[model samples]
Target: MAETKKTSATPTKVAKKEKMLRVTLVKSPIGYCKDQRQTAVALGLNKLNSSNELPDNSAVRGMIFKIKHLVRVEEI
Candidate 1:
């Protein structure tokens, strides 16, 4: 006589990852509108050549877009 073994089936899933963006204040916002200046401060860039690593999300993208002329962005 022979013995048999049983096995179970399982499914595999892919892992998700979080992305980050580098935001830098390349130009001064001194002459820009109050709203633009506020946006820079909101992004934690109060001085020239300052930078912040922020999550790559809609909210952060929106802020960067607002100050595109006054700042630079990079992917990390």
Candidate 2:
């Protein structure tokens, strides 16, 4: 009898799932906290009526919460 060798196959890679949230600046941050202003800046919103799409993560959510009164959020 002859000896035989077995070969293993490579595993397939799966794509990661990403979530998105639409944020819009409705109000001004003139009298808001510094952190709130910073968050707005991070979101790329400097003036009113500006909108941005950000990853729906905990950190972004926290920032939105910090400036909830200064902006509006929608799931997209």
Candidate 3:
């Protein structure tokens, strides 16, 4: 006689979550150039020690890179 193994009929499903970014102004941009300062402002950080939660995308990431020295970033 031969024996066989049984498996479940339903397939496993996996859920995916969208990536997000938390950007905070860690340093003052007063001494920075106009473009850098404007970049920070465009990210919605108008004051020192301010933070904004934004989506993780190329445009936003590019903006962050522009003022990476003036701000802190965390993935959410």
**What TM-score do all the candidates reach, one by one?**
0.78, 0.78, 0.76
Q: Per-residue alpha-carbon lDDT of model 3 for 1-76, expressed as tens digits?
A: 8988888898886876779999999999998799999999999999999999999999999999999999999999
Give me the overall lDDT of model 2.
0.90
Candidate 2 lDDT over 1-76, as tens digits, reads 9998866687666987788999999999889788889999998899899999999999999989989998989998
How many pairs of residues collide in model 2?
A: 0
Q: Compose the digit string of candidate 1's lDDT tens values, residues 1-76.
A: 8988865576565787789999999999998899999999999999999999999999999999999999999999
Each prediction's Cα RMSD? 4.1, 3.4, 6.4
The full ranking of all candidates by lDDT, starting with the best, is 3, 1, 2
Better model by TM-score, 2 or 3?
2
| Number of the candidate with higher lDDT, 2 or 3 | 3
Error of 2 at 54 (Å): 0.5
Which pairs, if any, clash in model 1?
none
lDDT of 1 at 14: 75
Query: TM-score of predicted model 2?
Result: 0.78
Task: Mark the 10 consecutive residues where model 3 has the least summed lDDT.
Answer: 9-18
Q: Which residue segments of model 3 deviate by more than 4 Å?
A: 1-16
In candidate 2 the C-alpha lDDT for residue 2 amounts to: 95
In order, the Cα lDDT scores of the candidates are 0.93, 0.90, 0.94
